[model samples]
Target: MENRIHLGDCIDVLHEIQENSVDLVYLDPPFFTGKRQASSNKDGSKKYTYEDRWHSNSDYYDFIEKRLTLCRKVMKDTASIFFHCDRNAVHIARYALDKVFGPEAFQSEIIWSYKRWSNAKKGLLQQHQNILFYSKTNSFKWNKTFVDYSATTNIDQILQRRKRDDRGKSAYLRDKEGNVVLEATKEGVPLGDVWDIPYLNPKAKERTGYPTQKPILLLERIIALTTDEGDIVLDPFCGSGTTPVAANMLNRKYIGIDKSIDAVHLTNDRLLSPIKSESNLLKKGVESFLKKDQWIEMHLTGLECNPVHRNSGADALLKEKVNGNGVFIKVQKQEEKLNDALNKLVKLINSREGFKGILIQTSNTDEFINNESKSIKIIKSISMQIREF
Candidate 1:
C-alpha cells in the first residue's frame, strides 16, 4: 500500500506490493551486534529494545539475503537502494548485496563520518559507518548534487579554462596572444562518497531513543539524490520512521514496514509532525568555527581567554574577569586606525552594564592620542612595544 506503515515482517509485506512499483529503497537493518540493543527516552521514562542476535553467521546471512531478494523484486528497473550498516556487518552485508543485485549493479560505498568523545577500547575509535549504494540497473534515476569547494581550493582552478598541452599535461587554455582565458561561473564540486553529516546527539529533539535510529538528514540526502518529487520510497526496516518522515518532507510517497508495533507507532507519530535538527556546522561551514587567525593567536599568546567566532565587536573573552564580569579583548587590525578599533570595543562593553574591555593596540595610528574610556583599557601589543623601544 502507498504511504502506509505495515506492522509485520518485511518479506511478507513486500509480497503485497506490486512488482516494479517502488522507486527507492533505504534500509538500516541490524548490524549484527550480538546483544540486546536497548535505550530509553530523554527522561528515561520509556525504554526500547531490539533483537540483533542470530544463531550463527550462516543464519544471519540467510535472513539478510532473503529480504534483500524480496526488496529487489519490488524495485523498478530504474530504481536504487541504499543499505546502511557499520563495520561489524559491512563485509557480510556487501556480499549479500552483490549476490542479490549483481556485482555490476553495485555503486558507491558511502562512508558516513562523524565525531564522538569516548575512550577507545583497543585500537582506533569508531567514527564512521558505511552505506552500500546499488542501482537496479544502469538507467536508475539520479539527481546531481553539489557541495561548496574546500577552503584551500585555489582561485585559478575554478576560474581558468583548461586544455591538454602537446605533452598531454593539463594547462590553462590561452589565446593566440598567450593570455589566459576565463571560463563561465562554476558550480561547487560534486557530492562525494564521504559524507560528514553529524550523528544525532543525546539531547537532540529528533532523538526518539530507538537503539539504532538514524538522523533524518542522512535519509533526506539519499531520497533527494536518487528520486524526484512524488516518487515512491520504501523502508522495509523502518525503526524510528526517519525514512517515511524524510520522504514525506521531500514531497514523496512512502511505505514503511516494521515488525515492532512500538516502532510502527513511533513512525506514525513522527509522520504527523516531523522535526529536524538544524546543524550550525553545515550551515556556516566548518571553517567558521575557527575564529582565531595567526595574528589573533600570536597577540593573545599565553593569555587565558576563549576565542569568539561569528562576532564582530570582540575577538575573545578573558578567563580572568574584572568586577565579576567578562573582559572583552579586541586586537587592533594592521590596516585599522586605533580609534576605530577602540570604538568597536567600547560599543560592545557599554551594552553590558558591568563588563570591561581591553584594546590591544597593534597599529601605530593615534599612538599619542588619548583613546581610553572609563570602562575600556588600552595596552600596547608586545610587537608594538618592541618596535617603539
Candidate 2:
C-alpha cells in the first residue's frame, strides 16, 4: 500500500480502514494541557497550533475513549498500539487504553525523557511524557533490540556462566577444581522502558513549523520495535506525519490520518523528501557524552579508554575491568586534594553502578587512604613520582 495521510476526524477515518490489516498503530493525540499548543518556524515567518482545552475532565476522557475505540477496530489481532500523552491526562488515557485493549494486553508504560530549557516557573519543570504500549493480543509482533551497556556495567562478568546453588542462590558455575565457567559471546543489554530522546528543537533540520511535532527518532524507535519491513503502521492522530516518515524510512507502509488540511499537506510534503535530523545521542549511544567531553580527553592522555560524561564523579572509563565490574579513571584537579578526588570516585563506584576506578595522583600529598571497596586503583603521575625521587 502507498504511504499516505488521510484528512478527517480520526475516529471517522479509522472506520474506513480495512479491519485487521494494520500491524502497528502509534498515536500522539492532544494532551489536554489546558492551553492552545502552538509553535512557529525558526524565523517566525510561519506558525501552527491546535486546541487541547476542553470544557471539563469528562469531556477530555470521552474524546480520548472515542478515538481509542476506533483505533482498536482497524488493528490486526497481532497489532500493538503506542499511545503518547503528557501527565495532564495520562491517567485518563491509560484507563481508556486498558478498557479498550484489556489490562492483560498491557506491555509497558514507556517514559520518553528529554532535556529542555524552560523559564522559571512556580512548579517543577516538566521533562517526561508517557507512552502506553499495549498489544491487541498476546501474540503481537515484537522486534527485540539491544542498547549499549551502561557506564558502570560489569563487562567481564556478563559473559560468565552462572548456576543456582542448593540454597537457590545464584553463583558462578565452577569446575571440580573451582574454575569459573565461561558462556558464549553475547550482545549488549536489552532496550529499557525509559527512552531518552531529544525534543525537536527550532534549529533542527527536521522541524516543520508544526505544533507538538515529535522528533522522527522517537517514532523510528517505536516503529522499529513493533513492526518489521513492509509491515503496515497506522497513525490515527498523525501530526505533520512523523509516524509515516519514520515508517517509510524503515521500509514500512504507513497510513496517517489528521483533521487539519495543513497537516495533511505537510505530511505529503515531508514524505516526498523525508529529511531526518541525525541524533548524536542515538548514534553514539549514551557513550556519546564521553567522546564529547573535552575535559576528559585532555586528562586521559596516552590511555586507550572510553570517556564517560554522564556520571559526574567518574572521568574516564578505562577499557578494562576487575571482578566483573568496569574499570573507571578519575584525575585530580589542580585545586583539588588527593582525598577529595578519591572520595568522588569512591562514591560513584559504591552507588551500585557496578564500576571500579582509579585516582590519578597528580600532586604531592602525605595522605594515603585505602578504598574499603577496593574499586579505585591509584596511578601516580610521572611528575609526582619524579618529584618524590
Candidate 3:
C-alpha cells in the first residue's frame, strides 16, 4: 500500500506486502527501556503510548530479529534500512542486525548528536543516539550530499592540493619548479556519520507529544540520502508518522505501520495537513550564534535589551515597549558618519508606525547632526562623554 498507515503489529502488516517492493525502510523500534513510554497531545486532549518493556534482553533480540527479517524480505535489492535506537539497547540491536542482514550489508553507525541544557545525575551527559544503516545488497541506491565545512577547518587544507610524501604522510603537492599546486574547484565537504541535527523542542509545530517522536528534519535527511522522488519508503514503527510525513514532503510514496490505534489515527490525521518547524540552529551555524560583539554587548549592558545579530540597522531591541511599540537601538561605530547611522535607523523606524528608534553615539569624530525627530532619539555613549571632558 502507498501512503497509508496500517494498525497492526509490524510483523503481521509487513507480511501482507510483496517481496522486494520497497525502496527504503526506517524503523524507530522500542529501545527496551523497561518503561511504558507515554506522552500527551499538545493540548493535553489525548495520551499516546507503547509498551517498550520486555521479559528479557533475549526476548527483545528475538522481537527485533523477526521483524527485521520480514522487513528485509520486502526491501528491494537496492533498498536500505536505518534502525534507530539509544544506549539502552544499541548493542543488542547491532548484534541482531548483523545476524539478520549479514556483516557485509552493514554500512554505518550514525551518531545523531544534539545539545542538552542540564543533567541531574552526573558522569557525562547523554547527547546522542545511534542509527544503524544497512543495505539489502552492495548495489544499494545512494545520492551524494554535501555540507559546509566547520568554522575550525583550515583554509589551506581546502584550497591546496595534497599528496602522499615518501613517508606516506599527507603533504601539499608542489610542481617541478617548487611552486605549490592549487586544488581544482570543489563542492562542499561530504556528509559525515556524526550528525548534529537538533531534537524536537516542546513548542515545535510538528511535535504531536508522542513519546520519542523524532524531528521531521531528521527523517527528511535520511530519506533524501537513500531514496529518490517517487520511490517507496516504509516505516514499521512510525511513531507520530514523522517518516511518512517526511516522505510525503519529498514527493515519495510512503507506508507506515503501528500497533497503536491512536498512533495510526494520528498518523492519518497528520497526513491530511503536515506541519514542520523551522530550526534556527540548522539555518544558522552554531559559530554564528556564538559570534557576539563584545564591544556592543559591553555598551548595552545596563540598558535591558536583547542583542540582535546580523542586522544592519539595529544592534539591539529595548526590553520594555514604548506606547505598545518596540524600540530599536543602534550603536554608532568609531569610523561611521553620524548622519549615515541616523539614516539607517530612520529607514527602519519609518517602515512601521508608532515604533521608536535610539542611536547611541560612541564617537565624536563625525559632524553633529541637528536632525533628530520625535520618533528618533540620539544619545551620547559614556565613552563619548568621557572623551568630551
lDDT of 2 by residue, 236-271 (tens): 888899999999999999999989888898899999
Q: Write the per-residue lDDT of candidate 1 for residues 1-389, one digit (tens) a residue.
A: 98999999998999999999999999998889888889998888878888999888888889999999999999999999999999989899999999999999999999999987575597788999999999999999999999888989996768999999999999999999999999878888999999999899887889998897899899999999999999999999999899999999999999999999989999999999888998778877788645437778889999999986545678899999887899999998768788778788888987999998888988677355665578888899999899999
Count clashes in each candidate, considering only residues at least 3 apart in sequence or on different chains. Answer: 0, 0, 0
Q: Which parts of model 3 have CA positions greater than 4 angstroms off?
A: 163-171, 175-177, 292-389
Q: Which stretches of candidate 1 lie over 4 Å from their true place?
A: 292-389
Model 2 gets an lDDT of 0.85
Cα TM-score of candidate 1: 0.77
Worst 10 residues of 1 by lDDT: 363-372
Q: Report the CA-based lDDT of candidate 1 relative to the real structure.
A: 0.90
CA lDDT of every candidate: 0.90, 0.85, 0.90
What's the best-to-worst order under TM-score?
1, 3, 2
